[model samples]
Target: MRPNIVVIQADQMAAQALGAYGDPAARTPHIDALAADAAVYDRAYCNTPLCAPSRASMMTGRMPSDIGCYDNGDDFAASTPTFAHHLRAAGYHTALVGRMHFIGPDQHHGFEQRLTTDVYPADMDMVPDWRRELDDRLQWYHDADAVYTAGASQATVQQDFDDEVSFRTLRHLNDRVRANQAAGERIPFLMVTSFIHPHDPYEPPQEHWDRFEDVHIPDPAHPEVPDPAQDPHSHRLRAMSGFDQRETTDEEVRRARRSYYAAVSYIDDQIGRIRERLETLGLAEDTVIIVTSDHGDMLGEKGLWFKMSPYEESSRVPMIIRGPEHLVPQGRYENPVSLLDLMPTLLELAGTDPEVASTGSPEEEIAPARRGLSLLESARRERSGRSGPEDRDVTIEYLAEGTLRPQLTLVRGQYKLVVCPGDPDQLFDLVADPSELRSVADAPEHAEVTASMRAQLEAQYDLRGLEAEILTSQARRRLVAEALQRGTVRHWDHEPDPEQRYVRGDFWGALQHGQIRIPQGGAEGAA
Candidate 1:
């Protein structure tokens, strides 16, 4: 019998916010305890720093760029092979409880069932013309009122939503176990409990906020460098209207950091509740629990607030897997791994073929052209104190929001190179400057290192068949214009509306009552 799987994924969670990962202010006791029984991957990264693409990559085990899911609004091709589909075909009951961000008609593409649906903004599918005409743009929360009041210092915005998601998940788990027991069938279920907290609106419950009030939040290891010669991308962020000139005050930064930590603690408490329930139901030993995040947040670091950068603060995430002692014991692997490895890894653990199937229509080609080895094999090798043949240098690439060119790529054994698309390159020696505070691309003394890293980056681009030519200034501007017109463009400066103010929650209810036009197209209307 294959072990049941429960993947608990959090949105926009940074590794530095976890106590196990060395956050002095963190209080993730449940996750820390799970870490004691599981193997923790210390250097896991997301294929894309943003939500939709990163989640898409994890579902497909392919790079976001490869699938044309380069930005937030781009929908995953429904026909693409997904890990859940593979497991479902292998006779496992797979279900997604929250926040899949499928963005299209075929939301439940792989899973046998979905417990919740359409948690993202409905306007994501609005027609291009309608999107262009709208003054609010793609901002969902702009029309809604703030969830937290001006005088309220607590992180109440996110707590209510997080609690609801957790409640739904626990109910599903308990019901599943009860049904399986009554039928005398072994429960081979794969349930993904995804939470949308810590992503934005960085608010937690009052209790959680109070817990971190006295904790000291440290500044980023490398503060903002005012050198124009450093990296053009950093300068680009600094040049944006609200983002460029904005510097977070120490009090505001501390408040934001405290809210973030409080969110983590809140999630941790929910995980504890679920774990206790699992133990009470006797599913603790047999079920494998994997906890991770889609990506990390900047949290007022480097004068920047959100993800979409190649910096470690945005790219690196936390991954902790617990269960099946014979398969994986308590340990920590520092080997750099990408969240793209999760699909194949989970399939392997479920005793199913990790390989994608080749049989499907043109619209349903449910297999990957290129696939990597499963991380489970690496875990086994690590447990035995041996190296796996699958162990090789990993490369991570990032493309700026509107630009089609690669903004950054890091080769594991070598150095990291940041490309400005049409500008000069920036190189950082990982050994010397892990924080990437200095650029050595122009330093004559490190000519050999620079050449080596540049060559490696070029080879990676060549292998991937990415366009090597950079976009012209006019072309870049046009691309941004097109993105703005398409409603795909997103600006982080606009604060998210408070959770209580989501009009969609009530608007969706109204749709059922025939209060609004049952438009020609799906949820967001014609487009």
Candidate 2:
């Protein structure tokens, strides 16, 4: 039987904030335990640092550029074939129980069922205007308020939404187990339980907040990047988020960090709850659990408040896969991988050939060249000592709210090259300078490496062409968003059926009301 797949995702969770990823202060014992017995990816990154684009790339196994997912409001076409679609086609029951930030009309994408409506709007309302000046921050963009008001809260919209997410997800797992047992069958399932925590507003429940009461929450390693030395992108992002307009104190920073940590712990507890349910239901050993996030938050790194930058704090995310020991051997892999690889990895785990599953309607067709490397194969290569830095290279793009032109990054070997049109190229040797405080692109000795990386970047992406396409997409989306708001409006937000949300009677009446069977020698059973 195919292994049941469960993906627990946290929104805007940075790898640096996780205990499994080497943060000693994090109180995520559950996630730490899972990492202890899983394949921990040390250099995992998101294809795009923004929420919507990153998730779109994850779902489709294609770069955001390939799918025209430039910003949050960009529409994810109904024709797109996601990993859930592939698994569903392979006879797996797929469900999304939480926030995916899916924009456009088709909220389910490919999941057979969406147990709850998304927390964020499923429309083009949050679209960014690239034609506007960077200093003119969009009202929808991040601001200094989230950081200034960071603290323990009695409750928040985010907390309420995540609570419902956890509740519905656990209930779904229970129902799945019960239903399968009643039918005397073991149908495989894929459940993506995502949470909109650790993203912003920096306010978690008071209980989670108290988790870091006495703990010393360390400040950002490199907090105050001098204005003159700051990279153009970072500077622009800071300005775009209105961080430059206000002065944030050390107390605010610490409080925000503490609350963010608490939020992560809250997510960890939800993960624990799910794992506990799987164990109680006798599905632990038969399930594959993958924990990750759509993108990482800057969390005041280098004075940046949020995402939309190429910095590690905003780009790198945690990728931990825990499953049957025999199937997924415990190990740590430093090879670079991105969210794009997740689609192929899940398909391979479902016993489906990615190449074959990738074939579908012309609108759903995934170009083989655009597919990501199978992480299972990557693990095998690493275990056999056949994996090298050259085995995989990750590229990230950010054409979202912050910048005038598209910013792209190439992560190859120990070097990271950042390039943008009309701006000076910056390259950092991550091995030598992990903080990326300095650029070596102009260094005399590393000229060859710089040239090779630039050539690779050029060969892979037509930066000029991509910029044009992004501009056009931005203009069209803005026009549509404006037009849709006029007169009678039809919103694309998903309104989950209230009647079918809980236990209810079907056409047969009262579902399976009191269908109990008493065994002669055993306890009572459900008929």
- What local lDDT score does residue 109 receive in model 2, on the 0 to 100 scale? 90
Global CA lDDT computed for model 2: 0.85
Tens-digit per-residue lDDT, 1-527, candidate 1: 68888999998889878988878778888999989879898877776777777887788777766665555555467778888888888888898877766643467768876765445642243222211222323443111111121112343435555677788788767666655745567758889988887766665677777886577767655566436655555555444313443455556666666777777887898889888767656677788999999889876566555666677787889989898878656688766677878887888877866654212222443322123446666666666767532344445555434233566555454366666457577777767987777778889987886787666656545533444322232244345445655645553211222333224656875343322223454333211
Give me the candidate number with maximum lDDT. 2
| TM-scores of all predicted structures | 0.79, 0.94
Best by TM-score: 2
* Candidate 2 local lDDT, residue 6: 97
Worst 10 residues of 2 by lDDT: 518-527
* Model 1 worst lDDT window (10 residues): 142-151
Collision pairs in model 2: none
